[model samples]
Target: MSPLPGPRARGHRLPMVTALLLALVGTLGLTGCASLGTAAKYDGGRLRIDGTDLSFRLPEGWERRDNEELADALAGSEIDDELAERGGISSSQQDAILDEVVLFAVGPGGSSLNVLTSSEALPPRAVLIDQVESFGGTDVRETDFPTDVGDSFAVAYRLDAQGVQADLLAMVIDTGDRLSVITVTTGSRAETDRVAEVIRTSLALR
Candidate 1:
């Protein structure tokens, strides 16, 4: 594993998943239209997150929730060292822009699936996985795979946070104008592998 890069002005050094959740919760009050107004449609068991052209099948038994609902649930929680100096603006200020972020979250029982898009371009895969593990994820393994859209970067890891031990499959896909981080969280590695294949096959740009 590479050394954990020092914190950047945009806090790129923070794990993408952890950093984004905290940032979203903090800025929810400042956003009205962008955070709550973005459109997502579900048709034929597939969900299309508007603006990002991210569409994928909703895994068996999984249900989708809007990002604003997530922000509301997580608003009171505080995360340390994750939001340091994001764009040299106050964490709350940086979070205010989260209205522009696109997020799709699904879960079945104790597992979850997330698709997120932001204007910020992410670093390459290796660096991204390292950053995630550094932020309390363990047993990280990189999985390179092919997708209909293009080359895909994926990582399998276990995250123990808030008393939950979540097995996660994280994939990064660059869509020219934004970066999409798709994560599948479950208790079984077999399940993660199975779902990862479905996501890669289904992903495409519109």
Candidate 2:
């Protein structure tokens, strides 16, 4: 089988792992909503993501989405090809789903911040690189930086396909039982750097 397209692939093509992550996030939302009885709250200029012990300060002019919106965005998308085949839909079903999918996003379309969680306990570095490579990323690079919450590793790469050139910054944090993948996507390298830096520095774990 041919490899799945990356996040920024032409049209609505997103990687299988990404689709899996989104599914996980949706499950977290539903499960958390039912049991936790809490929702994302805004206080002191920060948007605290509900359903989990995660929160971040929202950057200037940035917007925050709720768990319901996230679920809506990932709705009807299979987490993997096996599921897709079993469901009798195209393996790339997410391509059509993403056309209307918008998660807990911040910033404009060209540049934005997205967060997803995984239950797997893995090194942040491996998760970061594997995510980029899995999405058909090229010119991948790794770096580290300090954040208000803790030290985190970042993976940056480019996706140039179908005449669309987009840059992505995958900021990964391994918080014991879960992996937080915060992606910053933009059309220009400078925008990618600027947006990611603002959000990264403002992050505060609570």
Q: Estimate each model's TM-score.
A: 0.68, 0.60
Model 1 lDDT on a 0 to 1 scale: 0.56
Q: List the residue pairs that clash in candidate 2.
A: none
lDDT of 2 by residue, 1-206 (tens): 99974432122123325543443332223222312223344343765544446566655655555535553433453334433432345645544433333335545443445565545443446555665565456788986656655446787777543345667677766554445667676676787788777777766667
- Model 1 Cα RMSD, Å? 9.0
lDDT of 1 by residue, 1-206 (tens): 99985433343443364443432232321222113333344443766656676677765555555767554444443432233332334556545534444554444444556566655555676676666655566798888766776446787777654344556777877665656677776666787788788777777666
- In model 2, which regions exceed 4 Å deviation? 1-16, 19-44, 66-103, 124-127, 148-151
The TM-score of candidate 2 is 0.60
Q: Return the TM-score for candidate 1, rounded to 2 decimals.
A: 0.68
Q: Highest lDDT: give the candidate number.
A: 1
